[model samples]
Target: MKVKLMTALCFLLINSGMLNAQVKDQKMGELIDQQFKFADQQYKVLAKNLPADVMPKTYNATTDKVVTSNTAWWCSGFFPGSLFYIYEYTQDAEILAEAKRRLTILEKEKNNKGTHDLGFMMYCSFGNAYRLLHDPAYKDIIEASAASLSTRYHPAAKVIQSWNSSDRWVGPVIIDNMMNLELLSWVSDHDGDKKYKEIAVNHANSTIKNHYRPDYSAYHVLDYNMETGEVLKKVNWQGYADESAWSRGQAWGLYGFTMMYRFTKDKQYLDQAIHIANFMLNDPNMPADMIPYWDYDAPEIPNTYRDASAGAIMASALLELAQYSNKAESKKYLDASEKAIRTLASDTYRSKLGENGGFLLKHGVGFLGQNSEVDVPLTYGDYYFLEALHRYKEWYL
Candidate 1:
């Protein structure tokens, strides 16, 4: 483990500008270190007993419970991905080993075509592994995952179906599907397969046409007619109502399009991302702390559950969006990202020692309307929180 750790550090020194010592905000920099310190301890304990063949989903504080899933689950990659981010920042050898172990457990899902989340499940974990380790095997896993994901793409609908026809979703292509295109884009570049990029662009263009309203707010799901290329319904599968903005869904749209802009350099994709950002950042319902409620239109308003996961995802996306925007526009996103990170790092969101079922961030909502996973610490929450931290240090500092 020590030898591998040293070799990885040596590679980090030569491969990228990801390592650093410069400190822009002394307070935040110190806070970042403290955050990782807590995380290092928490994960060491949290992951010490992980199932031999699966991934942790979220920690349930109410029941003192820890739920886990097989690699086929959509969220199965986040635990390892978050660990990789922490390992990148702290160079913790044990963390890296745990992440690698989880990655191997998750590797079999490369051919899972039953869902559209291969990108979330495979790319998030293996993608980070490939980026940091530069391992050729990781690329092979990613390419196979991309192939599995592309099978779900419907040519007539011009979108990747997020789910098979289920009692709830019914062959819908949700806003969340935007997050999966990164894998497709990467395969296009690495394998010289234009088909992968073509599928991603088609999905993006179709999503813009059908999923978004005039105000740039998005519905959580859009039921599509694959045979006729028709939109059947636009509704929120996870939020309060058909008209409400599920906070994390909005974040997915924000991050997805911004990422699409990065891959394709399409002005329309950039404009779409900017429009979504403007709507979300300026919403009257946005909380003072910069963390958003589970649903923007929840009847309870201030009393509704807050989704720290959404806030974390948005902050990470905003930091990157700031880099692409003009100076005047950039400040809003950068400031928003900074404030959100500060709030998450606070005792308000950050867990106490060994508390919150071994999760780092607190108060994330999975699906309140379904009476499940409400106000718990989620794996994706921690994943995006670490990602936001990584962005903060690299971009701001």
Candidate 2:
């Protein structure tokens, strides 16, 4: 009798846990549906307002001015990337058409090698288009863009040059450059050019050595001596202090390493990503809502501005990272992501339809140290928010 009672209790517990999971998934599914619908509607307004040849950047509500950027800007790809994500979810024809129109305007960047943002400016926009449509024309454009990006690789430094010579740094590589490596990785895979992949791995390894601190939090920029393969300095250009943790930079590192691991099955990259994720999520300064402030170590603490862009990027990376972790770790990462998704979907971060300059989320700080785009709805914030929502819908719910 005792044995039978114990067996019955175990069965009851297991069934209760299963039931709870089902309920949670059902609630999350509804939330994803609602957010997608809202994004689809909001982006239509954005598409209508965008100037013929430029991309949406941010909006100033006080001035009712919608700021835009040329194709060469680092953020040019995000607006189209967000459109692609929304169209994938909603199957909206208008969104799809707008994305294509923007692609035409952005296509010329494939040959522009002067900037390090080819991966962002090309891959995020045309790459998604190719993935969705499987168009050979898009493939040609991607190839050209990858070639352009490869010109920026410095063999001696084992890292891609992020910016041309400037007074700030001779050969500066920013943490954000990691996000661009996906373009190179994809080109290597598709074109069977070993050099692109080689450059990517070398860059990743060099960044792991030079960009991270003892605690695994990444520095924003590493000024390198291109000729001799020496790191000249480690500094934070956008964070509050030279050593402070910039929230978006941390998100970029986490997302970038996770992506590298996906393409390479590299345990080293995966381990680095896990360390970075933990550093960000477990930091004492991380808010209860999981949306980090603009700088983790900012002086204001509770008074600092929250970066929805950082929160979105982190949430998206965590969701992907959860897929590759052990069962226990996966659950932890997923729960953290779900919490962030819920918070971002709330009114506090998510913009109402037709509001926030038709952007999806609000309160993004582009460069708080420079007081640029402070407290605005950033294009990348909307891009990653939609990406997290799409990831949840596709992989989890």
Top lDDT: which candidate number?
Answer: 2
What C-alpha lDDT values do all the predictions have?
Answer: 0.86, 0.87
**Model 2 lDDT tens row, 178-252:** 998999999999964779988999999999999999999989989999999898998999998878899999999
Model 2 TM = 0.93
Candidate 1 — worst ten consecutive residues by lDDT sum? Answer: 15-24
Alpha-carbon deviation at 96 in model 1, angstroms: 0.9
lDDT of 2 at 308: 85
**Which model scores highest in TM-score?**
2
